[model samples]
Target: MSETQKLETQISDMRREKNARPFTLAIASGKGGTGKTTLATALAEAAGMGVTLRDCDVEEPNAHLFVQPHWSRHTEQNRPVPRIDAQRCSACGKCAELCQFNAIAVAGGRAMVFAELCHSCQGCRRICPEGAISDENMPMGSLDCGMQLKDPAAPINFISGKLAIGQVMAPPLIRAVKNVGAAEPLNILDCPPGTSCPMITAVRGSDFVILVTEPTPFGLNDLELAVETVRQLGLPFGVIINRADSGDSRVHDYCRTRGINIALEIPWKRSIAEAYSRGDSLCEKGAPAKPALPQLSATWPTTVSVPTAMLMPPICT
Candidate 1:
């Protein structure tokens, strides 16, 4: 087995033998407008057991709209951007050469670093012979966590990573968001759309993934890409066909052919759209989607390979 697969196998063994952490689920979509956030919020509301709904869509987080969490804890997330001291150094171009992101350059007899381009690897600082490079804090985003509902039986903890208005360093901010005290028994990660770095970061440590998609050609096309992404990471995942009736039966056919599980099918309705527009969650008391949530949470995990530690990055500061 490959390294990732071997890690996955060990994780499964640990989960079964050591009873490590509770199951974590990430709701993601191939493309936007696939009802991913909608399902994620509903699942968190209904999963109970003090589940945390982490909105990992740092770039444009909308889970907060549906979660309607009462804010209690908030903190800024920062990344290190280089500060080049021109006075201390000859333009030897060492920092530029060491920067893996090409964020630094020595041009026109001066050294320059692009704040946005820097990955904060600190390699430039480490490699600088003249000690001319230093790190400065750059705000990438913020983290917020609180309760979703007042009821004790199903009180939900909500956490979100909100990226700065124009910043692109979503991965680091996402890493910061994961630093919260997510002691809840269950957690649902509402991942960003697509299979990019941000989305991967959001879903990294999830035990199982719910790939939400519409029933259109566009949805299927992107869903294939997302499937490849998750499979590449050796993550076990299934599909959810949102607006199942809007498009043809291609999605179902595709899943069946691939032996992929279809966990839930949410047919589109005008009322559902209306509730969403009003910032109301699907599993609200009188909402139409309330009755099926428990089943939704229970159905997919029947065939899971447990893990010891989740697919997490290095612990954040």
Candidate 2:
């Protein structure tokens, strides 16, 4: 059998197995405006109860808008930034020189630090000859927790990361958001768009990934990059084409030729767009995406024996 066919068979087998550990599903995209959030929200709703949805798009997290979860806890996220104490030492420029991010600069017989550019690496603090540099907690963002208000008793635990406006670092906040307790049977992470640091942080430990994309040139171009990223990370993943019928068939052809499984497809629909504008899940009343949610959330093995392991069930034929 072809590689793609074998992978498809394993996916089917995973759905039949009953695994105990909650599966972590990361819904990611290569670029924006691809209806990634819409599908992620709908899948969470379809998975029904016992699900935890973490919005890892700290910069533009909007999953909460659709879910409208009743917030229980809101905590500000902070990270340590190096601070230079003038009274203790000279303007040796050591801190500025060691700051690889150009966050600090010493000139005109003075030293200045740009908090926004700082990565909190603490190299400045350690390299300071006179111990003039110390650490200060800088507010990076906030982490909020709640439950779906619609069904409070069986509400999906909702955790969202919002990076402070103008904040450069999101990985820390993403980590904080994921650190929240998840007792649900399934954890769905709405990953940030693009294959950047934030996206990697969100999908770092996921069991499976759903790559959402359109079928246009832009989508196909970015999808290849995203597919490479997940493959490099050694995570089992599948593709879903949004507005499948609207664009050309390059995406389909690429998937077929490359042996990638097109897990689900959502055709062009005005209602889905309208519903999304209204902050709705677009999963109402026999939606096409509803049927695929079960397979998306199926019990998939978390670990593969090797980095070269292709998509296949270890315990199933």
Candidate 3:
């Protein structure tokens, strides 16, 4: 049996053993430098839903810098890549011809497989009449599991997956982190920055999406992009303006014109940054944003209650 088949079988077995009832919420931004992680952690702490934090930003996960976690467990996440058996050698160039990802190349009576380009489709193996193709697992990363120690009085479960350095793909790791949290918990996924594959993987199947943005020109530009991304996904999403008072009013203006709910706003405050630098929980510091943060916890259920079509604007233009 190929490695891909074995891994798929394992995943199926695990799913059968665990019946998961999770409410996945993704925190996203259209660009980097936005406070996606900060808002995700704060909202998780505020919701008090025994939330599991998945730092889907495998490229650079920083949530742990704030929410201290106890009892971390590391587990390997891997993906399948095709392996060619030269000895079984028909070298007819069939595999290379069939591969859509350009993962296989044949030249000079030799076949080379570029594992990174492989999407693990297993088509090459199935099509190989000579049985020269097989699949193998490549280590992607390790997932760290622990509980957030925001309040010694109440702790929340947190899990993050760190992709192996130099790994290009991150969606697999994000999916792995989320799979672990799906067993029986409410989840708040701190998605990676940008509105690309990684962001889509993080937000896909989420109950709600909270897009964090500022009010500057750059912020407005990115917020529009993020909104369009979520809209394209047909997911229910709202806006949260961070550094709300510092920039132009265009963000609020855009939201008002679209009828998008301004879920919460973290004002421009030196203390917020100071507390963050000190690795202090916003709840403990009485951060001016605390009240506003918890207000989201109250608003989320109601937002979910409204029909998605009703919340969306008449025309996305």
Candidate with more favorable, higher TM-score: 1 or 2: 1
Q: Name the regions of candidate 2 deviating beyond 4 angstroms.
A: 1-22, 87-98, 106-111, 126-132, 149-154, 295-317
Q: 199-265 in candidate 2: lDDT tens per residue?
A: 9989988877889999999999999999999999988887888998998999999989987877667
Q: Give one digit per residue, the lDDT tens place, for model 1 in 10-111.
A: 776765643346567788988898998999887776665657888888888888888778999998888988898889978899888888888988998779
Steric clashes per prediction: 3, 0, 0
Global lDDT of each candidate: 0.79, 0.78, 0.77
Give the number of colliding residue pairs in candidate 1.
3
Order of the predicted models by TM-score, top scorer first: 1, 3, 2
Candidate 1, superposed: residue stretches over 4 Å from native: 1-13, 16-19, 87-90, 108-110, 129-131, 301-317
Pick the TM-score winner.
1
TM-score per prediction, in order, is 0.84, 0.78, 0.82
Tens-digit lDDT track for model 3 on 1-317? 99988867775655443325555678998867778888877766765445677788988888987777885687888887888888896789888999988999998897899988876678989988888877799988888888866565546788888989878878777888778844435578899878888899899898678899998999888889889999999988878888889978899999989878887788889988887778765565567666666566455444543443223211101
